[model samples]
Target: MADELIFYTNPMSRGRIARWMLEETGVPYKTEIMTFGGTMKSPEYLAVNPMGKVPAVRHGKTVVTECAAICAYLADAFPEADLAPTPDERGSYYRWMFFTAGPLEAAATNKALGFETPPDKARMAGYGRFADVMNTLEHAVSTTPYVAGDRFTAADVYVGSHIGWGLGFGTIEKRQAFVDYLGRVTDRPAHKRAVAIDDEAMKIAQ
Candidate 1:
């Protein structure tokens, strides 16, 4: 018998990113929709994720948390999806993925909260200046058809989500490169399906 895959998430959270990746994998899994300040903080769900956060995955005995890690793990776990990068693609794959998860996420959140790192304190920040992070990210998506390379790998799933969310919420600048890159990566059946699922879930929650 094969191990069961379980996904814990809320429709209104980063779980949407994992939902897209799960759809891309074309695998059978179970979904648990957790509500904020409710089931999410329950002892049962807390056991799965100490932080009581949405977007955690449990594949049999193994548990994976964090959106980037979930994307990479799903790609590797279901090799048939071909979302994981090849040997040569590993460099860019890991590079952009981690960059989005760390610097990009930190910088965007801080900016949205109206907090900026001072010049002298920039050295202490992992993302440095907000402008620098934006410039580097624009160059990344514009230089290649996808973040990892010519192909759309798990890296795109992670990177694209951040860019898309940022653009949508006005957190990230509306650069031409960012808009164009988002259009390229999201024009897929899996993305469509994922959006539809989450949208319906949102309606229900409302």
Candidate 2:
């Protein structure tokens, strides 16, 4: 049962984040590539994730879904990877990680689709509007070397990937803080390997 980790993802999907985390963990897992509207919709894949989403992982009998959850889970599961934050650092770690997954993701997607939250109804919005989310994120990265201070933990993997992708695709507004932080995270050897593998897979996919 040593290599019982199973990773289900598509190169063209958010699975890249999990892939990067997997590479960082140095875990030997199986990759099951799924296609949109094809095998991804099948009953088999649906059983793994009723949401029928990519980037789900099965660790022995435990199944983990959502990119952020998978990354965080692996950090604890493979302690040798040293991706989890210390007890003292857990506050910031969980804060920014969930922030990125929740508010940031929603705000960015809504903005990308040309949807704007009413200014008067700001409280009704999860992110309180896109600019607020970006400003909060900028402050987070600008003040620390990583999301959770000096250490690069699973939090950075989730948050940094969002910042990187947001900047690249013009979804999130670019800030110098985001630029610097992305450079720092993307330069990691594990991140590079993950990107290379996904890039090749994407090329072959096309």
| Clashes (N, CA, C under 3 Å) per candidate | 0, 0
How much lDDT does each candidate structure score?
Answer: 0.94, 0.90
What does the lDDT come to for candidate 2? 0.90
Candidate 1 lDDT at 77 equals 93
What lDDT is reached at residue 145 by model 2? 92
How do the residues 1-206 of candidate 2 rate in per-residue lDDT, one tens digit apiece? Answer: 57499999889889999999999999898988888888889999999999988989999999999999998999999999999988887988899999999999999898789899999999998899888998899988888898898878988989988998899889988788889899898889999999998988886552
Q: List the candidate 2 regions with Cα displacement exceeding 4 Å.
A: 1-3
Candidate topping TM-score: 1
Clash count, candidate 1: 0
Write the residue-wise lDDT of candidate 1 on 113-156 in tens digits. Answer: 99999999999999999999999999899888999888999899
